[model samples]
Target: MNWKIWKKKNDHKKKKTKTREWVDAIVFAVVAATIIRVFFIEAYTIPSGSMEKSLLIGDFLFVSKVNYGARIPMTPLAFPFAHHTMPLTGTKAYWDGIQWKYHRLPGLSEIKRNDVVVFNLPVGDTVALENQEPSYYNLIRQSDWKTVNSQYTITSRPVDKRENIIKRCIGIPGDVVSMKSGIMSINGKIDPLKNTGQMPYKIKLTTGNVNFEVFSNLGFKVSEMQQLDGETYLANATSEMIQKLKPLDFVKSVELYVESPSTNDGDLFPLDPKRKWNVDNFGPVKIPAKGWTVKIDSNTMPLYYRAIRTYEGNKVEQKAGAWYINDKVATNYTFKMNYYWMMGDNRHNSTDSRYWGFVPEDHVVGKALFIWMSFDSEGSFLHKIRWGRLFRGIH
Candidate 1:
């Protein structure tokens, strides 16, 4: 064998054009990033003030898939990095032609109570392309299905491709959850997260013309404060903020704004006029766990109907005063998947499980770990970065 000639030939074969090298490097980077995002961890941002005070609107968080198990992508054919829609084009980013059944890779732990969790929006199966803020169902409730359908472009999304939402898990499987006067009680015990959560408060001032700057210094956004009367204003604030404003000289009284249990403003979960469940006062309804069986009746149907029919994928119908699931008379129902009750830390401002009902286990995405970066849009150029919130662990 000619050793020198053989070595030179091999070396020449190994050498690549600049364009080929760049293409190989780019492909490798994209594959590596996608794997890490799907199986390990991914970045998320607080787009709304729903988790205010605990997790701010500008905080960028690294949600951990290992904490509650990484949910296998149901819609596997997707553009890398884009969530639901393509950037600039505003077109569908994922192909729903191929979908896998719900499966999760084993993780360090199951989702626990009070854990900040990210999950697919349960009611987000249908969405209005033009106006997505109120949700498709909510828009229908406000007007009617016919009106909303005519008003905007409507589309249905698969389980994983639906909008991703982050909230605190108030009730885990088999837990009884309720609320009274804007305070939540889980299993008949008051929620401990209430102390850290924010709600609307009626703040009365001693003088009609008081400086709003004082409230701003106390971390209350001026836009969130609404004047109710001459000397009274309604503001969304945390318990800590309420405490700080109480002893102020110009303050008359700072009281929590609790809605009356009797108030039937409608636009709640179940949407039953008879139930009269408001945001401030609702149920002792139990969160369904896997294999949990319950007798199906007219009363219980209102609560679990959506879960059984939609989340669990059953063909449910009522005929001749008899309940039928999958065309079979169903006097009793057994849940196939565990359900969770999720609520925002900004209790008053959030649209959560209180409105849409239970979130199935399959919708679970990841657990929020910490804020890797925080930017304040309301701050000045030099103070735009929230330095203290950077690298802060999420509760």
Candidate 2:
């Protein structure tokens, strides 16, 4: 071979080798990241103020997938780092051509009540909008059903591919959950987390100007307060904060502000006017446990209908007012999976299980471990870092 030709060939081989090395490194990095995310832990940032004092907006957390068992990927074929949508392009990151059944590896502990948990949104399986802004469930109810149905495209998502939501798990499997005038009761007992959760309170001022300064001074969100009347203001506050307000000289009364249950809000689960359950006054309904069976009838079917058909993967219908499951005329439903009730710490502002129904076991992602880093977007550079919130353990 000519000397020049041989020298050119050697140069090309070196360039090819370098390209192969770079490709190998890229592949390794992607694989390692995906493994870490799926099995050990993954990072999540608080996008909204739903968790407020417990978890602030801009707080970045390291969620532990192993705490309640790492869920095996149901929709495994996807872009490595993205959750559901491909960043920038706004397209689906996953391909659902091949899907797997729900499975989880044994974990450190079971999900207990009041544990701040991260799970896939229950009503997120079907979305009418691309971004799914306020939440599909709320959007549909708030808008004219026929208008929305005709105007927007509806997309379906698999269990794992749905949007992720973080909230405090208030009810576990088989536990009866109810909210009496903004107070959560589990299995006939008031939730012990009264001091931690936030709810709207009517603060009636007896005398003097509204001391709005006191709210900010006490670390309460001033934006959450709304002036209802001259002396009366509605504020979303924690039980501890309500105690502080009650003792104030200018404050005449501090009472929990509950919406009238008689007013049929179609936004609530079941969407049946007869249920008469509102956000502040909700269920005594039981969370379904694995293998738990319930006798279904016209009265009970409305509550568990979504769970039976959507979550548990059963075809259910009513013929001549008699319920049928999986084409069989059945009066009883044996739950195939466990279910949980999740609610935001900031109750009035959150769209959670109260609006949608129970969260199925298959949708459980992981338990929120702690804040690794926190940023305050509303603050200046020097004050941006929430130093106190950094590395704080999540309850």
Candidate 3:
């Protein structure tokens, strides 16, 4: 045997073996990450100020799947890291080749009211193509919906594939929830508002220079301010700040700028013209729990219609003043899944349960545990890190 020839062959084999080992390691890492994400916990970023002071923009969170029980993957064939779409490519990251039915792994506790939660956006079922000015829904409402539908690919996504949104659960299963003049009451009791709950206030200023520092010092985000006249201005404010501003020397009078119920918005859930429920003054509607039965009629239809048809996955219809569930003539319908009412802590600015109705149990992702990191996009380098917010527990 030639020792030199044997040495060359041995060295070549070692190189190939090393390459295969590297590939194996990479595959293993990806698989482990996917499992942890689907069953344990996942990272999320606050993309908007919907939750505002409670959960701010630029705050990064570690959501715990174990809080409300980890939802079994309804859309399991997705890309390893991506949730819905591939980055940059703007294509569906998940494959519909295999989809599992709704199931949840047991968790430490049930979802309680006021828990900051992450779930799929129920109304994001449709989206527009390129060249929409403001929003896809806004563009659809401008003119004939049929024309807009023709141009865009309207996709009805599964419970899990829809966009992920985080909000505070204001009303849980079996709770009667309502908002009265921007104040939330649940089950006939004034549900204590979160520290960050906010609404718009119309302020009448006396003959004096407006103090911007006073609003900031009093802990108001002060989203927008428009001077209507020399003395009056409309601005957004937190509940506490609104009270604080009312007694201020510069402020003559302060009142909530409530939206009229008659003013119809296309974005409201149920999309019914008869129900004059506005964001500021919305329902005393009951949240549906599993096995709960309710009598159905014209009055109740608008409330639970979407819950039965879309959320619970049933075909409901009304004929000759009678209600039917799944093609069966019936007076009452039983809910198949637990439903929640979620609202942004920043009440005035949030697109939440007030607009889109209940969030189905299957759509529940996790409880927001902590803000691991925080950044301020609008702040300079020294001010970028929100020092007080880092590693803070989400209330």
Q: Report the C-alpha lDDT of model 1 over 37-100, residue by residue, as the tens digit.
A: 9999999999998988888888999999988888899999999999999999999999999989
Candidate 3 C-alpha lDDT tens digits along 87-190? 98999998887889899989999999889999999775655655643455554334311223445544466679888999999888999988777677888988
Off by over 4 Å in 2: 1-18, 127-155, 208-211
TM-score, predicted candidate 3 vs. hidden true structure: 0.86
Question: Worst 10-residue stretch by lDDT in candidate 1?
Answer: 140-149
Cα shift from native, residue 72, model 3 (Å): 1.1
Clashing pairs in 2: none
TM-score of each: 0.91, 0.87, 0.86
Best by TM-score: 1
- Better candidate number, 1 or 3, judged by TM-score: 1
* lDDT pick, better of 1 and 3: 1
- Give one digit per residue, the lDDT tens place, for model 2 in 118-200: 99988746767655555555654554111244455656798898888899999999999998777789999998554667788
Model 3 ranges off by over 4 Å: 1-16, 127-155, 221-223, 243-247, 260-267
lDDT of 3 at 84: 78
Q: Pick the lDDT winner.
A: 1
